[model samples]
Target: MRTPLPGVAAACGLAAMLLLGACTATGRQASDGAAVAPSPADEAAQQSTVDTKWGPLGPADRDLIVRVRQAALWEIPVGRQAQRRAARTTTRRNLGEIARRHAGSDALARQAAVKLNVPLPDQPTPEQQSWLSEITGKSGNDYDRTAIARMRTADGLLYASIGAVRGSTRNTLVRAFAEKCEPAVRARLKLLEGTGFVTGDTLPDPPQVASAPLPGNPKQPASPAPAATALLAGR
Candidate 1:
């Protein structure tokens, strides 16, 4: 072939260089794109869920576990204080029983926390501590009334929570824990109510009923107040 022009030779050289550069870049990319294992932090993020033989542990289940423990934390002290200060013999006896039950509940809650790998609070919440402080400031009948009212209100709320968890929880351990708490809380409610201190205002409102009357009956007779409601109201 006739000798290539200088310009043509330079153009050819530039093309070859560009082609080589492109091939090298593509090879580098392919090598770098090979599968690599995730880092430890990434693995932890991906495995956020805790699996159990009973079922997957959910946030609600974790909450119930912690709350049960916290309840015992504050209530036990208040009950013990009531045992010392309640003027009525019956109230003292009830407080003693409540303290004993709470101790048992606390022990179970600790064991459950260990088994479930859920961390528990070492002490009561600030609000619970405030209630404890309030009870501690009073004595005799005053202490009894304050302790009963506070405990009843707190226990009533917790009782409802336990019932809800007991009914809905998928984890067998959590369900069992809630089942045990439900009746224990109910029994405590009855005990607190028996102290003649649980007022109507302190009790949680009953579940709402639909106001719409049935097709046949234009007016439904006013439902009788619940026995507990009536009893509390009279106090």
Candidate 2:
């Protein structure tokens, strides 16, 4: 081939250098991208390894988180409705306070889920939805009673769950969350009880006693009187 012009050769060399530099830069970027901005899954994986202020979360901790989140989602909206439609000032005030607390609780649950890589449901459980629908359709005293009853039922379940988690969870984070939530739930339960709307399941279960001996059955054999009692009688 005829010798290439000096200017053409120079241009060709520069283009090759530019192309090589671009490829090298792209390779560097590909290598560094993961470290520079971690994906949520990546972040979660990293978090799983690191020791948390509370002990590392376990399955029970995750389950508690999901349950609390669902409760919050269900309660907050219904509580708002109760605040607006409840006939009594006390009902309205209590509902308002509960709504505020649940809102905060929901936020905490979301933060925990993100950190733990747990997926949260966007909607409440079906039972909670049904309760909400029932409460939403009522007005005045009817609404008040329904709202309080629903809250009582929910808080009762929540209280039980918290108790279970408190006793079982080893993770400090889960324990802390349950402890923080317990007082609010108990306060709501007490307020609902005061409204007289929580009369059914809220009542303590009747003491379970053994059935009276069947009429025809011989009574349990009486134990022999103590020797001390016999001596006293003789005296």
Candidate 3:
């Protein structure tokens, strides 16, 4: 069987818990202030929680938060390397902007981790360190290409995780954090794409809804079309 998406699994698990809690609260109370055995639904809900990590979040939300912080930490050093090693003026400028953006994102991620009482790593994950080493070993056009490709891959993975957290996280803090960082991540991806080093296949899928037309655009209205139209057009 195909594995369920993390967000979906988390949502189902959360819903089951809420339903179980509601049932327990309304359950018949015994004479000695003792609670009766849980119903089958309650048993199933308890089991669901066991299937995933439980706290203020399910497994998916916790994983997403960790990955986001890791990505932020990873990007800062890699972006700096790109700034120093990229030969093209445009590539160097874009990398500089990327480094600046991720520095800010790293701070935000740290703040979120503190508020959520989550422990964040002092350095990037092992896989990220490997990518950094590979990028650092190249120079000129090769460095530019390698750097952009690595960033593209990282951004794509972050994009997917952020999208998942924003949509299904039970914790309000995590949802808000994901929403806040999405635009910068998206903008960085676009900048990397503009460098012509990353290919379309390597990038994450574009947003389903097209952005509003610019002020002077005549072919399309400034206001977005109906959501359905945008979805259909994307397809």
Candidate 4:
């Protein structure tokens, strides 16, 4: 007789549950008992598809990811270094999960860029259009339509997404960015609140969120939300 791998089975079950939760809006519909189909993230994780080829993220983009993750760690309240470690681990884990599952990071970044008015505060015409088109290139990744993407800039990269997630996992990247990034993200939030994030340009300063301290880290950047976190908060 074979022994049951309870732990392994439990982990797998949790993952599936979380993944389904990622699309709460869609899942909600399914919960209503409509017999909805599985999602791309689920299909990809379960079965390989030749039609979908995942792209490699550049170093700059990865850096932005790290930056945002860090900001999130410090923002959350903690009593010890171990607690901080837990927060960071949680943030990165959730970030990776979001990136893999729902294409969260890109979604937040695109939203933030638009809301924050990512175009340079100086040049406001063709340059902005060119940059906008560059980031918004039609259908870059399956995640592009949904991931949290951070835009690079002279000052720093801009991040955007639709929702956020809770610990253990951020069911939605948007919620993660919103809660962790907080007041600063709100302050750094651009006046472009209405402009198309992927198309509109930033003026100068892009409306700094604050001139004071980071959420939990008062000694941190005046508007110090991670580039990725900022993207989440932007929208």
Over 1-235, each residue of candidate 4 has an lDDT whose tens digit, in order, gives 2232222233233333433433221211133324345577754433321221122222222223333443333222111222223223433333333223222433454453343332211112232333334434433232221112222121122232211222322223334344544333433233112212322232222323338753565566466447886678957
Candidate 2, residue 122: the lDDT equals 73
Task: Write the number of the candidate with greater TM-score, choosing between 2 and 4.
Answer: 2
Ranking by TM-score: 1, 3, 2, 4
Model 2 scores a TM of 0.60
In model 3, what lDDT does residue 93 have? Answer: 84
Q: For residues 77-145, write the lDDT of model 2, one tens digit per residue.
A: 977877778899888888878888887778878887787676777776555676788888998888998
Off by over 4 Å in 3: 1-55, 201-235
lDDT of 3 by residue, 1-235 (tens): 3343223334334334433332112222244434456687755543332221333554445455566677767777777777777888878888878888877677777887776555566666555676778889998898998788778766765676677667766677777788888887898998888888886544434434347854766785577558887779957
Worst 10 residues of 3 by lDDT: 20-29
lDDT of 1: 0.69
Q: Rate the local accuracy (lDDT) of all candidates.
A: 0.69, 0.65, 0.65, 0.30
- Worst lDDT 10-window in candidate 2: 21-30
What is residue 220's positional error in candidate 4, in angstroms? Answer: 53
lDDT score, residue 65, model 2?
Answer: 74
Which one is best on TM-score?
1
TM-score of each: 0.68, 0.60, 0.63, 0.18
Query: Considering summed lDDT, which 10 consecutive residues are worst modelled in model 4?
Result: 146-155
Candidate 4 lDDT: 0.30
* Clashing residue pairs in candidate 2 (N, C-alpha, C atoms within 3 angstroms): none
Runs in model 2 deviating more than 4 A are 1-56, 200-235
State the TM-score for model 1. Answer: 0.68
What shift in Å separates residue 35 of candidate 4 from its native position after superposition?
36
